[model samples]
Target: MVIVDDHALLAESLELALNFEGYDARRVELPEEPPSETKLVSLITRSQPRIVLLDLDLGQHGSGVRLIAPLARAGVDVVVVTSSTDEPDWGHALHAGARTVLSKTMPLGEILGTVRRLNHGLSVLDVEDRERLIRAWMGQEQRIIEIRRRLDQLSPRESQVLEHLMGGLTVGEIAKLRVVSEATVRTQVKSVLAKLGVSSQIAAVSIAHQADWRAA
Candidate 1:
């Protein structure tokens, strides 16, 4: 088995423990400066482990989630062992053809037990749970599409005003910051509210939070 993760200490520890348990496991640390996807995939494929354990967050290397599809396509049994509790992340992994997603919070013994089961050609993940996560991921994707449609209705300046509102600014405050009149700011705020389909600033901000919007 091969472990691909950026947390060197944790990866090394897991590797040592798995080896001690009589399983041939090794750690492949994701470097801070990551290589292109093609090179990265090539390196992983060369190792040719029976099973590949991966982390979703690969530090500056960004999400290793995208690797799931290609690795699975190459006939690698990709097991995701991650710290992320987000259902959408789990769902995304399942959609990308991962064998299963396991939490790091699960006891090492339990994790190893699952690996043993996989080696023996037994089912590891529950079908119901897997289906649930896939549904959550699909729902999350739909919500993002809808949110984009709403926000995309805003003019460029309205987008800026929405960002300012999310930053905890009042209309008057935004006017001063943008060197505009109070009436102009209020008009823009009204337009933002209308475009976002929210009657209040609080609701509009909630939408931004859901979209993980950042001020530009």
Candidate 2:
């Protein structure tokens, strides 16, 4: 088994535990600067381990989900062990061809049992559960696309005003910054809310954030 996680301590602990449990587990420490997908795949291929434990969040790479497909092609089976609470990430990992995603909070015994089951040609998750998570990921992706479409409806000025709102600025502050009247800023804010199909500034800001909206 190969463990690919950023945290040194956690990796060490898991290495010790798995080794003690009679599985040859080693940590694949990534470089300080994130490597290219090709380089990453090369390192794992060196060991050619049957199973690789992957973490979804790898610093600069945003998420390690992209690694799953190439690794699978290399004949490595990945079992995601993540501490992230993002349901979308969990679902995304499964979609990228992970064996199963296990929470860090799950009991150690249960995790070991999962590995043991895999060794014996058994699955940890049912087909229904995998389908459910994949469906959830697809739904979240659709929501992001829709929200971004709404953001696209904003005029350039309205987009700037929305940015100010997200930055915690008051209408008067935005007006002064833009060299415009408070009334003008308020009107833009209203237009922003309307175009976003939201009722308030907070809702508009939340939608912008959820969609990761930003000017090119």
Candidate 3:
């Protein structure tokens, strides 16, 4: 097993406990000042641990949720051991392939027991936590459906304009890309904003992000 967390003291303690329990657990070291996602992923790949105990907030290194899917695909079961109380964080971690989400506040004995069970091919999640995750997923699904409906209301030209807007392009830049007059691009932008029920280009981009939408 491998532990990936920015809190050095907590990680070391967890490693010691795991080892005492007869598990071969180790902590990942980031020699670089601020670790990159690529470097962290490579370290896990080389270690090839059966289970990865991950923390979502890696200080300056950003969220560890990004690593969950890739680690799972690489045959490593990810157990998110995070202090984050945010529902979105929990939802994202589980959606990205984490087998279990354990709060850092959980008793050490319980944490170790959960890990042992996971290593033995058993999984566990509390009933309340499971319900929260289901609710979050349902809410996300509804948001996606609404965004798709709004997108479908757009005309072909309006859709093209919205895509460029979401790409961070200026009106002038979009006009240049499409070889259209700036006035024409502005007109299309207005139509897109109206159909999407947004007031500005930024709002349209926000909608795209919220729905995780990209141009088809």
The clash count of every prediction, one per candidate, is 0, 0, 0
Residue 18 of candidate 1: its Cα lDDT? Answer: 91
Two-way lDDT contest, 2 vs 3, winner? 2
What local distance difference test score does each model get? 0.88, 0.87, 0.86
Summarize candidate 2's per-residue lDDT along 3-110 as a digit string, tens digits.
988877777888888899999899997877878899987886687799988888777655779899998888888899999877777889999999999988888778
Q: Write the per-residue lDDT of candidate 1 for residues 1-216, one digit (tens) a residue.
A: 889988887688789889998988998755557899877877787878878889999878779888999998888888999999999999999999998999989988888888888888899889999999999999998998898788988888998998999889999899999999999989998988888888999999998889887655
TM-score of model 1 vs. true structure: 0.90
> TM-scores for all candidates?
0.90, 0.95, 0.63
Per-residue lDDT for 1-216 in model 3, tens only?
999998998899899999999999999985657657677798877867999999999877778988998899998989999998877678778878888888899888988999989878875776677668857966877887898899888887887788888878999999999999999999988888888888988999898778777666
Residue pairs in collision within model 3? none
Highest-TM-score candidate: 2
Report the Cα lDDT for candidate 2.
0.87
Candidate 1 lDDT: 0.88
> Candidate 2: which stretches are off by over 4 Å?
none
Worst 10 residues of 3 by lDDT: 30-39
